[model samples]
Target chain A: MDRKKNISMAVIKRLPKYHRYLMELLKNDVDRISSKELSEKIGFTASQIRQDLNCFGDFGQQGYGYNVKELYNQISAILGLQKDYNYVIIGAGNLGQALANYTRFDKLGFNLKGIFDANPKLVGIRIRDIEIADIDEMENFLKSNPVDIGMLCVPQTSAQKVCDILVNGGVKGIWNFAPIDLTAPEDVIIENVHLSESLLTLVYLLNEGK
Target chain B: MDRKKNISMAVIKRLPKYHRYLMELLKNDVDRISSKELSEKIGFTASQIRQDLNCFGDFGQQGYGYNVKELYNQISAILGLQKDYNYVIIGAGNLGQALANYTRFDKLGFNLKGIFDANPKLVGIRIRDIEIADIDEMENFLKSNPVDIGMLCVPQTSAQKVCDILVNGGVKGIWNFAPIDLTAPEDVIIENVHLSESLLTLVYLLNEGK
Candidate 1:
């Protein structure tokens, strides 16, 4: 967990993207990969892939390249995905419900622990093995058995308030899709997942492509 | 837009992030800034900010600092935020509806044009002055009225189908909020806003902070 030594944040961010690309290769039964092949799959340069990978260890052999399964395992371990991450969704609307039922996460080592909503009617509702709990009781529940992360699905106005509550409720991390830039203390990190920004970037790329 | 500029994708990706930080400075009435100040505010090194801004032009003075308002306008124009970008949400579910009413877009010049959904019950319904249209009518609608960007908010099972429909409907860009990735041609940029990846990063940061 030493922040300075493990890898740069930039290198760490690319691991998941590379992992996704490598999983596609593995699915096609491709067992060996060169830095060039890894870079091509991810739109990064071969040297850049070598450099990013070298931060951890020598993933690719000189002539033999990389063993796909071995490389994938190393990446998963680096990303802390070797073990499951238990999480709770803070809203129960379509977005939250969709996240709770999302099958894509099962393969990625994420477990939906439970869902929390302020609505009384939605509380006591069940999804998979987890039941939706009232938001009022969250602090007490969290104190007893705290989850590793909280997925924010609340409205924009409620985003910061919910984040503050989540931090106080013993939640260590957040997956915020709320499109709000939360200011947390240096210790608590808030990464924004803005759908609008992504759309805007794609538009710029398309505009440039033409 | 020149692909041979040797610009790190990390820096390219941060353009929007940079824009957001600048907007924050403007909102707080900070009229002047420096590379060092901007670096501190945005959590980048001064050298990194100088290098990133060097790609476009020198917006800073020799000894004095950067004129915040001028630099903000320059960055905005470079990012293509000078004109309002009209974008449509392709699904009228809770996620899309919530996005249509979101306030974060005002600062970034995003105008939510309308919403489209496959459900008959949702069609013709109005939210925030934009009527929900049937997916079957999207092609004709796009031809008559063009939108610069399309956001895919449908279920994961139907994400690829909807993306294909949008591409065939003449959309050159897509922002996929669904868990699954959509396959688009190389020329057409498809940004995968992988919801879990953001969470994973936050979790890793929190663990390290501890």
Candidate 2:
């Protein structure tokens, strides 16, 4: 497979959606699907699907369409899910605890190695058998454990500080839930799950016609 | 104060971000900001900021820049934060409970009216004085209470079913955390927070150069 260079961010964003739909098809034991059929399920246009798949590699055949299992594996590889990621949650608050308990990430090869919190009451609690450590210990913990991803669930005031610790401690990726956007080096990737922004967007759209 | 006709989705998506930055300026007692200053803070170009704000109304005078409080208030109104939205969470698992306990939404004028879960273990448990009810009772509850938004944190298999019930009961918006893309009527707005896809995006970026 000849790898394509400089895939657009729009195409990168769609890769996960492709991965998701392909996974669903695999679950239902669907052996093959045409771009038109996949488009109907995924809500992207058929041409858009063909174009997106072509960014990573030639996926679908002209007459035979796409082999479901093959497409799924290709997207999975494109999404970098072929390997496991060791991670840590920086805050053990309601959101952090919830994310810690979410088993879906585990299924997708994200392994949670530690959970840290500043709250004394929460610091000793065990979630999924990984005892919550004091936030103060996170720097040393990350030094020894060597995390690939750091999940930021801390409050906004402390988010940057926590993020700095993660970056200095060698974590390359940040899955931020904190409301504030933390600054990071160019090599580090930050993906924000801004819940407030998302809700406000929904509210704005719900009232768009009015 | 004539609003621009047909604001693009790209501009609409950036509104919440502008709202957030403007609110921060207000918090710091900063009364005015140039587009360049805001651009530095927000990571968008000065021209881009001006273009986005222009979608809703004329903001920012040449040289005088923008009045922080006024811009904040206008963006708040534009984002529909002026009115309170009564909402229900349809699954009381980890993510649902995390969102329920997320007090930031409450501060932004989203009121939690009820919480519903199919799990008997979570039923009747009170989160911020609002008790979780039987998931089966949600349809009847919405009939009497009339929520504006439904937060779907349920499993993939049940998300669409739960979404349909909310829509049928007259809910106009959905803040979805489930992994699946849900179907709703044209008028009903759906905003998704796909955590798995987000994590995958980060993983893909982290490994992009490898």
Candidate 3:
């Protein structure tokens, strides 16, 4: 069964954690895992895991555990990481360059296609076998390379403009590092990745004795 | 009344957007706004605004709406952001540098104390008035600076090591950009600012036609 939208947003949020832990099982050559063992590994309750897994339908029988590989594939497919996407970076600044060098993104099926920058001076700069191109070249570049995801590393001042360009260029989605929010067409998705905000929330939590 | 735990998390989540919209209101010089008007401006339902705001107790007068300045102050205080926190960015890499230049953080009462890096070549370098200190000097620097919040922009492999050091030096909260899942003492709060994961989930939503 397809993952249900009716499922709680909290359940959707934890799918990545479940996927990560499942990948560990795959790595260890484990063939199957009981919900109890999985919960122990991930520090989650077993009943929550069974309920979460059941939302997508029965992956295991009553007395048996789930097939590690099969469950991993299902969660991976649900997360859209089963297939690698051509991931390009827009605006080759410190943020973009840092993301380009970030090795973990590649492990989860994000392939660095190229980098684009609005600055003339940065054009043609090479980072990890990816050349930084002029922002104006984004349209033509995507037309040829067919990038599915574009990481917007542009400035807050230029975030909306750059996102518009990417959206018009047919980018399916964006990973925006800009501090500002960009409203896009319903067809195009934008995820605002603000690190400091998350940290501040953690500080708020620590102060609250959480 | 001190904001409760539930109010703290919920308020902190809304603060960034509220702050952004408040700045927009300030720019437009829109003074008085009712719950309905505020909801329309931010695309939140009136009931959601009322519920979210009411969790911290009634801030708006009946029918007369909320005073812009007064509501903003209430939100800031509820977010524990009325008092400025000395914030430091550990790992002066691409993400670190981008965060160093994030003006919004400071506008929301976060002071960028310094950027810490282990690379000898990067040591003593300055990014937007935040000096780059060697990670070796982390304990000494943190003791002297006494920052309440730290934003981690280090590599995933270095996450645990950095957290160990930071916690040892009295850093109580961390905003981790690295992909690694870190285990910290209960006293030390750690929040994973996983950008790509959030983006990939959005891609999953689009592919699923959500």
Candidate 4:
């Protein structure tokens, strides 16, 4: 694989969309697809799709287009979906429990190692067959368990503190459900799934249509 | 407000981010901000921020920059946050319950009118003070209550069917949490918050860093 040193964030963001579309096609037994066909289905222009895919390596041929299975496999590898990543949810609240029970995580190779919370009443409770660990044991647990990602489902006030603990514990990635913005070192990657922000976007679009 | 006839989706996507940052500034008692200062905090370029803001209307002054409170209010109105939108959750699962209890929705102007489920066992249960209604009564509930948005937290198989009900019952927007890509008429808007896709993006980023 010819890895590009500096790929644009825009291209990186669109990769998952492309991967998802390809997965759907593969499920439908689509053996091959042209850029034009992909563009029609995925909403991105053919030229833009070609440029985005070319960032990694040439996966498409001129007349032959792309092999759906091979392309899907390549994208899966590129997305690191081929590897099983161990993750711990910092808060065993409603959102955290939802994520813990989310079946897709196992399908996508994200293994939920544990769920943790500060409340003693909630700790030791079982969610999706995993016992909620006490928050005090988080750092110790990280030392023993190889957790690649930390899912922050705590409140705004505790999010940053939890983030610091996660980073200090050698967690490389954070998927923050907290509303607040967290600052992390350059080495750590953070992706925020702000539910409110997404809802606001929908509201704006709905109003705009009117 | 001078609303542009054609606003790019990219620009529309950034509006919520700007609103979030401005809200933070307001909370911190920051009265004013320049485009450069806003860019530094929001990660968007100064020119890009200016261009995005300009799409709706000129909200900034030459040297005085912008009044944080005023800009925030303007953005709130532009994003339809000023109007209270009634929303109902289709599935009374963990994700749906989380959204119903999400405090930010009330703060932002999305009112949780009801939560519904097909399970007779789960129906009539109260989540966030809203009693879960039976899925059979969904059409009747929509008819009686003016619900602007339908939050789809159902499984992949039932997502499209629920979406159809929401649209046919006169819901304007559908905030889909289901993994499937749903199809709606041109008049109705749908925004998908695919959790697996988000996790895949994080995994890809974590791998890329290595």
Clashing pairs in 4: none
lDDT of 4 by residue, B1-210 (tens): 447458898888888889999999998999999999999999989999888888888889999899999999999988988879999999988888888888888888778888999999899888877889899789888888899999999998899999999998999899999987789998888999988888888888898846
Pick by TM-score: which candidate is best? 2
lDDT of 3 by residue, B1-210 (tens): 544654645555776577567667776888878989888778778888888778777788998988888787776665567687887888887778888887767777778877889889889887886678888888888778787777888877788898888888788878888766788888877888776568657666656633
Of the true interface contacts, the fraction found in model 2 is 0.74
TM-score of each: 0.76, 0.97, 0.90, 0.94
Candidate 4: misplaced stretches above 4 Å? none
- lDDT by residue for model 2 over A3-23, one digit each (tens)? 635888888888888888888
Best by DockQ: 2
What are the DockQ scores of the candidates, in order? 0.37, 0.75, 0.54, 0.71
Q: List the global CA lDDT of all models.
A: 0.76, 0.90, 0.78, 0.89
RMSD per candidate (Å) reads 4.5, 1.3, 2.6, 2.0
Ranking by TM-score: 2, 4, 3, 1
Residue B125 displacement in candidate 1 (angstroms): 4.7
lDDT digits (tens) for residues B64-106 of candidate 1: 7788788888777766777877778888876687677666675
Q: What is the TM-score (0 to 1) of candidate 2?
A: 0.97
Task: Evaluate residue A186 in candidate 4 and report its C-alpha lDDT on the 0 to 100 scale.
Answer: 89
Tens digits of per-residue lDDT for model 4 on A1-210? 447458888888888888889988988999999999999999999999898889889889998899999999998988888879999999988888899998878877888998999999999999988999999899999888889999999999999999999999999999999987799998899999988889888998888845
